[model samples]
Target: MKTREISKRKCIGCGEMKPKKELIRIVKNKEGEVSIDKVGKKPGRGAYVCNSLECLEKGMKSRRVERSFKMKIEQEIYDKLKEEIVNE
Candidate 1:
């Protein structure tokens, strides 16, 4: 019998390694549209974060997601992330 492997992604917010399903995904597409990607199927650069508001705050304060994606993250993206975190 073979054990299935769980895909792991590092959380940009808290610097923790979490399974894909356990974290929320934020994607920046080639067109430069940044949004919270709950489905994780969006095509483009992606950042992983936990579901907690604390994680989102930490990420926003430190710009960890910006570091991960190698691009300047706009305030609107942070707003969307906060909105998604709250909805979750």
Candidate 2:
């Protein structure tokens, strides 16, 4: 049987291409809810980022995440993301 291909996505932080399965997905839902999509199955505009804190920092520094999501990001969300990344 042929192997099914997993999706690939590029990180907006460091401009690195990574498999969708390997990267963390951030999404803006239809109702404008922005959060991490662990299942990679969320509906709405999505952006990929590395699971690394460094990449997250870069993304935050450049506001790449906000630009990609087309919305303002809340500081609390960033703090939560940071905490998650650090723990991981």
Candidate 3:
């Protein structure tokens, strides 16, 4: 019998390695648009963050998320992400 390998990703916020499905995905498409990837199927550069506001704040403070996407993140985007984390 063959065993399946679990996919893992590092959270840009908390810097922890966790199962991919357990983290939330944020994507930057070719159009340079950034948005939360709820389905994880958005085609583009993707960054992961833990499903907690603390982690999100950490990432924001350290500018890790901005570094990952190589772009400036707006307050509106962070606000949306915060809302998503709270709802989750």
RMSDs, each prediction? 1.1, 1.6, 0.8
lDDT of 1: 0.86
Give the per-residue Cα lDDT of candidate 3 at 13. Answer: 81
* Candidate 2, residue 24: how far the Cα is off, in Å: 0.3
Q: What is the lDDT of residue 22 in candidate 3?
A: 99
Q: Model 3's lDDT to the true fold?
A: 0.93
> CA shift at 86, candidate 1, in angstroms?
0.4
Across 35-84, the per-residue lDDT of candidate 1 in tens digits comes to 88878898998888899989888988898888877888778778877887
Best by TM-score: 3
Q: Worst 10-residue stretch by lDDT in candidate 2?
A: 79-88
Model 2 misplaced regions, further than 4 Å: 1-6
lDDT of 3 by residue, 13-61 (tens): 8789999999999899998888889999989999999999999999999
* lDDT (C-alpha) at residue 87 in model 1: 81
lDDT of each: 0.86, 0.88, 0.93
TM-score of each: 0.91, 0.87, 0.95
lDDT of 1 at 88: 80
Predicted structure 1, TM vs. truth? 0.91
